[model samples]
Target: MSTATNANELKITRVYDAPVRAVWEAWTDPAQVAQWWGPRGFTITTHSKDLRPGGHWSYTMHGPDGTDYENKTLYYEVEECARLVYDHGGNDDRPPLFRVTVLFSESDGKTTMDMTMTLPSPEAAAETAKFIKKAGGNGTWDRLAEYIDKTQSGRESFFITRSFRAPIDVLFAMWTEPGHFSQWLAPAGFTMEFHDADIRPGGSTFYSMTNGQLTMYGRAEYQEIEKPSRIVYTQQFCDEQGNVSRHPLAPVWPETMRTEVLFTSEGPNETRVTVRWEPCGEVKPEEIEVFKQARGGMTQGWTGSFDKLEAKIAGSQE
Candidate 1:
């Protein structure tokens, strides 16, 4: 006689805007994974992503409220261009990590994916359904569906679609060195001049700015650097010397903010740049609320700066 172990399950389905190839890359590539891996107001910071059987993927999910959710997962199976399976709760110390399988198939030049998660227990399944926000089984499926919308086989990464007016090669070069970066890397009416721009994996940059008497200093530490394609760095408000420091106005602000910037080339002359940021230090509820409120202003400032960049690019070429 043999004893049997039973486990619970949660299933979800989502259609993507991308092709099968792009969808697959998004799920596998570290840079692509960071772009849309989170929900309405969350971003991913991958510490380690080794996609292979018995390997593990670990990362922290940053919430709009400035909270950090650390996670881990174990890869069970991978069939290139076909499927991905992993034990998620096995991914972390969480109680209900289970086997999750995803199937990717093509329909009318589009890719459709189906996901099935077998939980360790009924309680875990209940957790997946109830926690619709935090990468519960259902939430993960929803994100997958959103991913397909912008990906395609043989196409570029998603970060490149954020819009760029400069020639692809020019923008690519600017990111590789510190001297060129000092030109127009700000959010309009503000420019960054690096005191030191050591842009390499494990290197750092310290820069000063003049944004209309609202001069702010920033420091960035590169985590990974793939020249002409991606640059992942942790950014923070800094002192005049470009050392990471507490925000002058708010002591409660996270001590360090991690941000990843990726640049993609559309054509010889077009480029796409995506920037993602998260808190690296402790976050309190009140500070989180205030930071959320201030995000809009920051967006406006960046848009203006990019707008100027477009003109600068045009004038130089003409």
Candidate 2:
């Protein structure tokens, strides 16, 4: 597979405000790719897709202007969550189109995708450029970003998964136990002060997080806890006395949220943790809007917290 792009090839690169795995999955998974693979107002129907080397992927893209384009791709190389080299063209005995190499990389919790399409010749590149410009290729990327953000369908759920170089039990204890949990739970620039922490099912926790000038209090009721497996909790904004209250910064936000975290062992000393957060209880329209608006910031907050948690785990191992 060619890793470098030539000057004559068509190259497009975009850095998505999302994780590497999420972005890679959207590009490789046929079901997910169909959601945003085509141009604006276009729908894709996949006939077959095989993601391995030498495999073939066939699909029909229907345009908003009542045109149908048949596409087929032969996978030359596939690297999980990293690179894909494929040759794509028209199906049904039609001539080949171009060879594309897409590379995925991550830095600071975000993903950058670089795609290069090399046509057969300069004439072919010129002809394809016209079609790409007329079809609005940038719109397809925007659609992809929207698809990744709305992954859980209509639900305003935030999901993130990360791998840790620590055992599942160690990670579980660090997450549930009071002192260790507080040490790395808060986002960057914030410090947590726990008033109470009861770690078992039916137990509750109340904490205040301060960032120099501002302080926010939160309470959580543990609904379910399975050691080294999963934890479900109900979280809400609260006052110093633990009285339920709207968020100090976003009064229109939901008062309560349901959070679920799953821990899975990848190896003897490796673990993968997945977190899902969703607003619960009676959510007003304005509250929903607030939640939607806060999604980006919330993701950034979690990413920062996880970065600290990773460092904490590494230090403890030493």
Candidate 3:
């Protein structure tokens, strides 16, 4: 059997809101580098950044529990404002595998970035380097996604649907009221603390969450709010700047996303809610893969949210 053909290959693409120059700064600047680099529970500490060809970018990551991990990479090709190629890996020799390419283009004063990563051949002893990229790539992509949601973005529209047991009024209240929203907006184990929720067209929902050690901001804009029946909005991840962002979990997830929640009363006290999602396909392959998740995922998320809202409202009524 041939060795090359048997190799495991992975391909992912994420478009950034910033130009290649800005991305290069985020990828190189020590302070900006540490701000959003590494995984959710990890933080980065940079030792040096040399962006030109043959130069190196070195840093260490501090995990939630105080574990330190070193990372070092050398840039191979640096075509400013156009492309960058590099070889990166952990401190030790895990074959130091994989090559990354980033390209940037400008149209109508907005920048587009495309990143492609290729791993070492199947023959490499430590062929799992790409899998070890959770430290920075995912989170880094997330920050770029933040920049995209408020600007030009991409991908097709997808839907996430589930039913709610409460009446249309009750379900709608959870979304329109800031206090009501704080109780059920985030995933389990995370608590949302709202700053304010403006519930009309052109209004916004601003909030934050403390997921153990990770403090993150979330935002949504209300477009067409048709009381207790329908609501349209755009949602995104962000930092202190309130710029649109991405999911902290997956990088390829869309940035600027269109969300629609429709409520149809099935009975006196039951409401059927249908949620649809459409990624603003500004990026290439990333937006194309936005709706590829298992159908069961939306069910679980909406179900959990419904359960939480039911309890919150039930307690209020009592």
Candidate 4:
């Protein structure tokens, strides 16, 4: 992801496994868009769509709690699968909140989507960003990834992203260095301790986390480590002696999960972290279903961990 140079703009970028044409179709087709457009738990009803310059799209987003949000988008530019420029978040009662520019590019059979949302002012942009986070708007892109994955390969995965105001190297170290990692990797109310620490390609670690009442052990085997950019590992629950085991509380959980973490420099002193998680080796259908059903819980847990990570970064700077 690239940082927005304009203070009034918010930028986001994501790469999908699908090709450019497939991704373009997913975004342009009303039926496909409806499958993964809004935040999780929310659905939309498209009253009309006119995909051309000077045309408009009208839709109503239905909230999980029965509330409905009407939206109107006016298109200014449309370049087949290359780019789109439009005004978003407007309705009959008010003007548009921001202008959106989206660019699509492909390399090595993967499609990269870059989006910029420009608000009226920097304050408005900041406020909107906060509101989006609180409303789980980021999940919309994650859902898109899931949709593409299911369409292309009959597989399921989980995705999450967060941006922190810290240097890329510092953020990367927090993930690779055992001390810094243990300080913030555990969920809220739990403390982590690394019994065996080795973080590198082909290396592994055994750790335990406890919330005073109960303790759980886990192991991670690192498969790849690209300095300050990417890390791939496989994680599994285990006993105190490091013997592989099923989740203590959720037996239906997959035994092993492959996690890929990508770190991108958004600015001189900021980094955006994106995580992709999927079942590793053989996985049963029941386990996959359980994983799909527990996405909400997974989001909450990861959010709590990120909060702690932010605090730790702040403390380090101070």
Candidate 5:
């Protein structure tokens, strides 16, 4: 944990769209770093990368202006998914231009990264800042985000099944009828405010779900409807008027998702519900990845809501 004496060092912080481990791998993995290590309009070709304490990494950054900057890095410390300390500069005999330290942290399943560049003298810091700002250090981080998403997206679907004490008819009504839906469709701590709801084939529903002071709008267009059996729909974020909107917290989230809920009669007094969720048409690869990354949170939300549904059904039966 060495500190820089110069007062003019450069420090930048960003919260990445991916988890901390993904961010750490992007820095240490040569293949991943080659995809997004340099500024915008620049490409990196790695000659060799030894990612360990006392190891060296050599690469050439090819700028769009046809200038090739030969770079080399000497790793000083490597703490897995936590910290990386290295000396990065041109391949020369003089003192390294700067000592770079990167710290990775995660909160609420997202990654926050901090990068500090320390130069030996204020004069050197001033000179380096111009090149860094012009070369687009910020763009480098932005590219890293795209790389992470591109690498993470896959053909993964979210699936969840729950058993309830109510009959199949009751469970089916809860999903297809707005009256029953308005009673137990939302998760704990959230209430639904319907702007419009028509739960039949080719019909749509729009609503705003509010939790305390926060409210989020959602819309669903029914694709398939089989009474007492299943319901298929395309769901998206929407405004009060039902216009499509981006997710409040995630910008790259898929604009539309295909949701299928199947109801089965387990017995005379029992029902089974299975939900299959996947991204829908024309979605960006990165956006699909974002959906996949959020599977955990989605599962939690569904679990909470299903628990409420189970309780509501029990009360009615009693």
Candidate 6:
């Protein structure tokens, strides 16, 4: 999935590995929607859901910090399994913040969801985009993807997306070029150095990251590298000598994890990157549980890296 923003609208497009009917049911069915309706660490209570033109769906979003936000959506148009148009972010006290139009289509047994939130002005749209990022609102879609993946394929994974103000090719180079990758791919306050980097299909990279006190070594074995579009790799904690090992602090972490990164061009100068992570080879139940439980930390780590990446890109532009 990818997200983009125009002058007065926020656009998001995602492809789900499920049939159109299944995707529609997962979205329209209140029972399934409640499971992944809010951002990470948030839940929702659907008070009343009437999925029809002129009907209303009311709910309360419960934040992680015990904050409850009331929301109401009035449907203007609803075509079963095809499209939806609704006014969202309204309650008894206020009017809707924006109008949303979502279109769903299926091809090759997979469903594509395209959604646009139309705001009143470009400034309003920009502000909303900032608010969504600050609140991790985008995680809601990732959660939806996870829900569908689990239900349809019995697979569990972690997902995150970020839109960068850089061309798709530039962003792709930032990942594949070791010199650029090491500049911002480390956790906050840490530095990364690659011993040997072969970032191509069937190749691998060995790198170490440190923050003065402790250093961690890892290896990424590239499985697929489609220029300017996608990259698939298997990552594992390893010794300085390049031998696979378990994380020193997280002994129960999965021995190997598969990472898939998709880069989509939002515009000529903007790109959206979506990353999915899951246990790669045979893994035990405990490892999977640890992976699931570490989502919050994973989010934080990736966010920190992204912050640095953003700064680096800004510096380059200047």
Scored by lDDT, model 3 comes in at: 0.64
Give the C-alpha miss distance for residue 106 in model 1, angstroms: 8.6
TM-score, structure 1 vs. true? 0.49
Error of 4 at 41 (Å): 1.7
Clashes of 3: 11
Which residue pairs in candidate 6 collide?
Answer: none
Q: Go through the candidates in order and give each one's C-alpha lDDT.
A: 0.65, 0.80, 0.64, 0.92, 0.78, 0.91
Model 3 C-alpha lDDT per residue in residues 15-94, reported as the tens digit of each score: 44455566666656688767657654567888888889988888888887899978888889988778888876645556
Task: Give the per-residue lDDT of model 5 (tens digit) for 253-284.
Answer: 88989988888665677776877778878988
Task: Show where candidate 1 strays beyond 4 Å.
Answer: 1-161
lDDT per residue (tens digit) for residues 41-158 in model 4: 8889999999999999999999999999999999999998899999999988999999999999999989989999999998999999989989999888888988898889888998
Off by over 4 Å in 2: 1-154
Per-model TM values vs. the true structure = 0.49, 0.60, 0.47, 0.95, 0.52, 0.96
lDDT string for model 2 (158-196, tens) is 555566778899999988999999998998999997899
Clashes of 5: 0
Positional deviation of residue 52's Cα in model 2 after best superposition, in angstroms: 11
At residue 176, candidate 4 shows an lDDT of: 100
Candidate 6: regions farther than 4 A off: 1-6
Those runs of model 5 whose alpha carbons end farther than 4 Å from true positions after fitting are 1-154
Q: Listing every candidate in turn, what is its Cα RMSD in Å to the true structure after a full C-alpha superposition?
A: 16.3, 12.0, 15.5, 1.5, 16.6, 1.6
What is the TM-score of candidate 4?
0.95
lDDT agreement of model 1 with the native: 0.65
User: Which ten contiguous residues of candidate 4 have the minimum total lDDT?
Assistant: 1-10
In model 4, state the lDDT of residue 155.
84
